[model samples]
Target: MPKNVKPVYYGDYLQLDKLLDSQQPHSKQYGPEAHDEMLFIIVHQVYELWFKQVLHELRAIYKEFCAEQLDDRALQLVAHRLRRVLTIQDLMNDQVGVIETMTPQEFLEFRDYLVPASGFQSIQFKELEIILGLTRDTRIAFDQQSFYNRLSEEHRVYLEELETHPSLFDCVDQWLARMPFLQFDDFSFWDVYQQAVQNSLDRDEEIIRQNAADDGQLETELASLQVNRDNFSALFDNERYKSLQEDNRVRLSQRAMLSALFITQYREEPAFHLAHQVITSLAEMDEKLTIWRYKHAMMVQRMLGTKIGTGGSSGHDYLRRTTEQNRVFKDFFAMATYLLPKSALPELPSAVRQALGFYFRHDD
Candidate 1:
């Protein structure tokens, strides 16, 4: 390492002067400053800082996925970085409580001074969403049109260009789709999986028929079981799965979904361990982000109730919609619905098992 030309001061290193000076509240311009406004500004500024760090980590992960191949080391780094993002998301969620310290009445004191600006205009957060594969079409109506219109011209153009690139979600889907284990010579893993699934469904139906209280309950249970049957069947039907994709019922491609299932099912094997960790981390990241959005929405309801946002959004209502719909990795969570018990899973062939492990037997 090169020696420092000049000894660095702690405050100077972090630009604390500018940071400390940035909390100039508009409330001070009219009359006696509202005390909570400073707190609000500081909280939002801290959020943006964290958003910047999250974007940095996401971009690195994206680059790794963009590679033609991801070795275990690369996968490990991706999982580690995703874990860090989740930790940051947890902190962000908890920060909502800090801002909630102010009452609605106190928020009203300075709220009027901040017109034409809202959380919707947070370019970094928007970029984070975009990089995580939130397409314009996938966004809610307000975000689809007005979100970009609200941004400055430079920011708008930049994000528009960014949308042209493959996002982290796209990269991950491609990576999983290209996984080589789905077809090993003549071995068809999905066929075995299908039979196991059918056997499990039959057992469930038998249990339901025996345990139902009455005719109406039996009918209801059978209908619900039929829905599961149809969904499981669709996993192997290309045309039916494509229809589900068109309806946005599922996001991952059929091949990728199957590959994810295979990895998840065989995660105990040496080769699949890191791959499963990466998949699990991505799912957890999505969950944490959803939790953050829910907390933020509740905080908005507490602060403004039915009032519209400063930037013309529907306040808590709009936030609630985003909390529910703006998900990129939800298919990972839904995959759990298709999992069978380990004991019921088809035992892999010895050769396939050897391929999925670190050691192989040597003939002398």
Candidate 2:
């Protein structure tokens, strides 16, 4: 390390002069400045700053996953970084409350002054979505064009190029598909798992049949059970799984889905603990993001009622749709459906147990 260096001033080091000067309210540009506009601008600027930090963490995590192999230490680091992102998401969600402090009437004072500039033009937020794997095909129909149409040519081209790269979700799917635990000699883990699943489904069917009082009730119960049966059946059948994928019912590949399911079911195993944490963190991140979207939609409704967004979106209605559709980690959430109880899980063979455990042996 260098012993001597130029003295660092706080304002210059943090660039407070430029940062503090950046928030110029549109309302002020015209006439009387709306009081609440400052709060709105500052809150959104803070959000962009946080988005930059999240992208920093996500890029590092993506590099780790891009490696040919992720050792336990690398996996631990990935999980740690993901946890940090989750913490930031919690803060971002809570900050929505700060903006909510401004009443709808207050928002209306400056809202028209900033015509055609909506949250839809938030390029950093769009970058975050693209990096996390919300491709154009997966986005809500209006969103597929709305944001693109609103962006400048430079920003639009940048995001279009970004779409060509493998997102964090893509990297995760490939990594899970490569998991060595999915195979061991001629032993097939899924065969045992499928049998256990069948038994559980059978037990459920029996219970439903016994509980149904009349023919109409029995038919309805059976129809619901059939849907569950078909979902489970698709897990073990490649063609059926592919059909589901084609219909967009699932996104992760068959091998990756199975590997994720295995890790989730036997998360207590020493080998799977870190992987489990990664999946859990991703699911929580997805949930937090959804909560943020929902909150934003509610806020929009409170402010604009049924009005169209300044950027030409259907406003609250469009945002509400995105809450349901613009998800990158839904596969992780859906994986829970395929998990069997620990009690129902087959006891691992001795060799498999040794392979999964972190034990040391020595000659007496």
Candidate 3:
């Protein structure tokens, strides 16, 4: 550690003077100040600050994933940082309630003063989304243009350049695809896994058949079962899985999907523990962001019912749609649908189990 350089004052270190003075309500510029406008501005400013921290964490995580290999220590650090992001996200979600305290009538006082400056112009938030892999194609129709169109030319150019780089989702896919345990000599894990899945599916079908009281009900249950059967079939079939990817039913590459599924299934294994935690944390982060979006959309509705956003967006409607569609880690959540019970999972071969564990047997 370096010796003391200069005396650091609290306000000077945090720039509290600049921070405290930054909140200038637009309403105050034209007419009597809207009291609640300060709260609105501060709440969003806090959100941007939090967004900055999240981006900081994500850049570090992205650099780690960009490596050719992620060792256990690296994976642990990644999980820890991701959990930190999740914690911040929880705070962001809860902060919506603070803004909600400002009544709709109070919001109206300053709302018209802020023209052509909607939440859509939040460059940090958009950067966070792009870095996390919500590409143009993945966005909803209105959002595909609105997100970029609303940004200033400089911000648009910066984000476009950012899009050229691989996203966290892309890096994660590559990492999972490169996982070493997908292959072994004289052992076929997926073969055994397939048979177990088939057995489980057969059992489910039998139960459904027995429970059905009429032909129509039986047909309906069978149709649903067939969908599951097709999904499981796609899991092992590369071409079929690619078809699913084409249909946008899934996103991760087949190899990466399989690796993620394998890690999730045997998360108890020493090597898979941190890997599983990384996936779980990413999924939770997505959920928290979605929750924030939903809360924000509701807030927008309260403030501007059926009103177009200042940035010419559909306001709450657009936000609500984003909550459902604009997700980067939905594949992780959907992976749960394909997960089989631990009881149904085939016991890993001893050699493979040993490889996954920390300890090695020594022959004397």
Candidate 4:
């Protein structure tokens, strides 16, 4: 059967090659302890690979968006990509749930062997943060302060090269500006917004597009975004605007549109609301991932309490900082409670403060 028909070589060369040899333990120390460490290492490596794919798709999706390639597919691709990310995140979350079962003294023996091998050096993780609309302005970027200094030059350069263009959210705004939908309803407004987003995506896949990835250009081309200053103010308060515009210098769009998206209430154009939804969803994903880090930290701390990390970090405290600082989409969380109805917004005081943690929403 094989000679007559050339067998289908079902091998994905790049993937198989990378996946098979990806997990490299720091030492020859192989025991039952290595079992959990291997589990720890393999899970993260696999997820980073997946994170790479997310960045690839995000860049492509963003490019299509900038070209004014409005359609429902554009919006859908994001959910598709993100759903996969969330699925893996859920898997990672479960992995954390499992790892958390380990005791502290058990973690101490080999923790020292892990010198400079912290997840903080994960290049792909940093890229994921950047693509999701986080920037260097946040505390995470300057984090080459500790074991993070262990980041390979390759990781550093890759991040430095990232276009930092208008993100998936910016693309959504460009799509929303195309139609005359007054509100975030299920009929014309929602349909147009949905279709326009998808249309933008399909247009990208089916056709050759341009370098519309940069927000500076996309904003100019799709300049008629209806959500404005007064509209933004009316739907939400001013601090809401500031919370959303944490990285005011990135210049994804004019501050008006950016803040309007994060802070403003749902006034017809679901600018703030959609941004709020995506931001919150992404933030949830980020929070889930932090669970993994904290679990890792706890393992290290329990095993080698108040000791140094294998990756040359301050161990528990270092990881605590990571868990606190690793938010890829901070504004989304900082402004989450505001996504609820005004009445509901008031009830969640902690969420309210977190959302307003970044900035004031007022204009002038």
Candidate 5:
């Protein structure tokens, strides 16, 4: 029963050496395929490894909720892992910059060698998406890799545990019963979460209303607070603003639980696609989620123009159709659009374009 009694290895680098040596180029185009290309592949592979860790954290968080224990450790784990995932995504986005520095011609030299291989086919990414409640798409169904097949099994076990449990939303309902605005089930998870946050809004608004009645300094301070945030009355009420966003996941989890879809084999279901509200709200963060497939499509339009994806899917043209994804989150966007300055709302979707795409001058 001794603690920390595991065996140790001296500067052996056994697994490290094996992993480092695994990258192989498909062609002799040293500049494109291997030179900078090796670095690109390494970045993606390492990110996948980090994603693996993030998924483990998510699984742990989901388990804690199922156990009816929304304790500090579970909260810390969720925040820590979400931060890691964000960090990973940030790095992934930054890598686009690095890859952009490579001239299209330089990439083209090795692009042909990539042949049937593409990053979209990453299984670890698919697993991460699934764990985060993304079980609706057939994008993960491209069955070719034996390695990915194995990882998916582990994914199922973790998801199975969540499916059988009370889920985070259920726990939220148990935690905040009798809330007038926050109705459960029939109201929808998004509505429930929206109500929970609105309760805070309601409280803040009440504080304002009361202060005006009293003509008091504290109420005046509350009313004059600055308001600027991704969501809600951003009136900088320091303590209250932080508090509102802080417990958001509890709301988000409740949302996830309320709208949880069942992922099965045929018309399969899993609660992973999130309760839909997350996606809708995510639009405030980036409307591109709904249109990421469109952006991806645009990249195809840029790179290969209309060429097919390495996976043999319908390619960029097909991607345009999916730009309208996120069934549950659609409402989130609809809610956000209501807050827009009206004139700004119509042009919102095309406001930003991803500079990176698939080409260079035929001369280069």
Candidate 6:
């Protein structure tokens, strides 16, 4: 590391003056200052600071995934950075509790002074969602109409341009789809796995027939089993999987989903170790973000009840919908539906096992 020409002072280096002076509450501009308004401003400022750090890490991860080749070292770095983002998300979720301490009556004291400004105006947070693959078409109706409209013209244009690029979700899908381990010369792994899945389902049906207390119970269980059968069958059928995508039942492409499934199933293999870690981290990241949204929605409900937001959203209703609908990497969680127990999984050939070594081989 290069030595500084002069010693760096804490306040000056960190620019505490600008940071400390930035939280000027609008409540003060009104009749008398509201005590809780200060807490509101400081909490949100700290959240934006954390959002900046998360974006920094995510952009680096995105660049790594964009490369034509992602080595184990690069994948390891990506996983590490994602862990940091998850930690920040955990903090953000907890931060909701801090703001919730301000009672609804207390919040009402300064809420009117902040009309026409909402969390919808948070540009960084919107960028975070877009980069993670939330599109205008994917948002709720209210969000599609007003999310960007609420932003300043410059910010709206900037985000609209950002929407034109391939997001991290897109990059990861391409990378996973390019995996060559799906087929090995004449050995069709999926063909073999399909048979195993069939056997597992057959056994499940037999057990249900034997144990179901009534014919109605048996019929319901069998119907559900058929749905699982159909879902598993779609994994190998391109057209069916495409239909699933059209229905928004799954976001990852069929090949990418299969590749992710393969890595997760054989994660203990030498080469798949890091790959599995990457997939797991991405799934956990999605889970954490969803948790944050739910907590934030609950906090909004506690603070405002059925009232409209300062930014003109349905307040808690809008946030709740986003919590359920806005998801990337949900396919990772859904992959569990098709997974077989270790005992049920068909063993890979010795040749196939060797191919999954520390050195990855993409055979033509």
The lDDT of each candidate is 0.90, 0.89, 0.88, 0.52, 0.43, 0.90
For model 6, residues 73-122, the per-residue Cα lDDT tens digits are: 78889989998998899899899989989999999999998888888899
Please provide, for model 4 over 287-325, each residue's C-alpha lDDT reduced to its tens digit, 9 standing for 90 to 100: 777786777677666766787666656768877777877
Candidate 6 worst ten-residue window by lDDT: 355-364
**Number of colliding residue pairs in each model:** 0, 0, 0, 37, 20, 0
Candidate 2 vs candidate 5, TM-score winner:
2
lDDT of 2 by residue, 1-364 (tens): 8775789899999999999999899998889999999999999999999999999999999998888777777888999999999999999999999999999999999999888888899889999999988888888889766658988999999998998999999999998997766767867787888899889999999998899999899999999989888989988799999999898889999999998998899898777788899999988998999999999999999999999988888999999999999988999999878888899998777787676543111112
The candidate, 1 or 6, that scores higher on TM-score is 6
Name the lDDT value of residue 289 in candidate 5: 35
How high a TM-score does candidate 1 get? 0.96
Instruction: Please give the lDDT score at residue 89 for candidate 4.
Output: 70
Please provide TM-scores, in order, for all candidate models, with all chains considered together.
0.96, 0.95, 0.96, 0.58, 0.49, 0.97
Off by over 4 Å in 4: 1-5, 9-26, 29-37, 101-106, 140-148, 163-280, 290-300, 328-364
Candidate 6, residue 100: lDDT: 86
Worst 10 residues of 5 by lDDT: 353-362
Question: What tens-digit string does per-residue lDDT give for candidate 1 at 251-320?
Answer: 8999999989899998897778888989999999889999999999999999889999999999999999
Q: How accurate is candidate 6 locally (lDDT)?
A: 0.90
Which numbered prediction scores highest in TM-score against the true structure?
6
C-alpha lDDT of candidate 1 relative to the true structure:
0.90
For model 2, what is the alpha-carbon lDDT of residue 136? 87
Off by over 4 Å in 5: 1-14, 29-36, 137-302, 317-364
Kindly report which residue stretches of model 1 are placed more than 4 angstroms away from their true locations once superposed. Answer: 3-5, 357-364
